[model samples]
Target: MFISFEGIDGSGKSTQARLLAEMLRLQGHDVVLTREPGGSPGAEEIRRLVLEGDPDRWSAETEILLFTAARRDHMERTVLPALAAGKIVITDRFADSTRMYQGLSRGDLRGIVDQLHGLMIGREPDLTFVIDMDPAKGLARAKGRNGHEERFEDFGEGLQSRMREGFLALAREFSGRCRVVDGDRAPEVVAEEIAEIARKSLAWTQKA
Candidate 1:
């Protein structure tokens, strides 16, 4: 099974992804935990270019191209191989992120994103957890990280707010695979919920 965790920055999706991987590993599952824009060597290089520097370093159109290229490299080098080996692949972020960030955040370019996705990266996670959080609080947590990859956070609270809404809408759009999880609770609480859902999904997939 391919699983992904997505949310506004600092919405705890990253932590949740890690927790899920660890929990599954403890249960004797073979799992591969990865993240987009940097999952493979080529994609890692692209990650630095797109994630660092100023918020205006790349326009939405340019970012779409860069992200797509990275995703293609990731799929070819990291994701596809592991899946073929029968390992469950879990990623912190995936194409859903691009659909929200580069597609809708800057402007109304979701159509272009979808077109590029269908042509270049025609895959989606079997299960996606969109951790929902208040934009203002998320921004504060993201900024508190003080990491070099602050380009997106630098976009300010307004962008985060829009992203929260965009992600929720995206969950609705892809209702079959997307699961919206509330992110305001304790980490353990959130992790438990995700683990239970993932456990059920994994069982169902195995039966199928």
Candidate 2:
């Protein structure tokens, strides 16, 4: 099963992803827990350049391309191989993130983004969990944990709002495969809900 967790920063998507992977592992299922833009070595390097460098140094289109480049490396090296072995792959973020951050929020080179999506992960996640939350609150939670924010992390209110809208748009477009969970709830509750959703989705996918 290929599953992904998507949401704005500090929305607890990563935490839930880890928990879900652990739960599946406990069930005697092989699970690979990873994150995008840095899953593989080459992708990690690209991630550093994209996230830590001067924000003004790269244009929006450049930013989009960099993300897709990292994604290509990640999919070829990590994601596909694991899935081919019939293991559950849980990713913290994926191409949908690029569509939200660069395409909708930054309005960059979206044509290339779409092209890469088609060429790369033509088969989307068997199930996608979008942890929905208010952007301001999410940012605050993120800052609380990390102490400081990075370039993309500090998008401020305007960009954050747009990103939220972008996520919703993507969810609607892929309704059959996407599920939204309330991220404002307690962590344990969120995790339980996600686990149930994953179990049900896996069952349905297998039967189909």
Model 1: per-residue Cα lDDT over 1-208, one tens digit each: 9999999999999999999999999999999999987899999999999999989999999999999999999999999999999999999999999999999999999999999999999999999999999999999999999899999999999999999999999999999999999999999999999999999999999999
Per-residue accuracy of model 2 over 1-208 as CA lDDT, tens digit each = 9999999987899999999998999989999999987899999989888777455767778888788889888988999999999999999998888888787676655667788779765757889999999999988887677632267776676777778888888899999889999999999999999999999888887899
Q: Which residue runs does candidate 1 get wrong by more than 4 Å?
A: none
User: lDDT for each of the candidates?
Assistant: 0.96, 0.85
Q: Candidate 2 lDDT (Cα, whole model)?
A: 0.85
Q: What's the true lDDT of residue 165 in model 1?
A: 94
Clashes of 2: 0
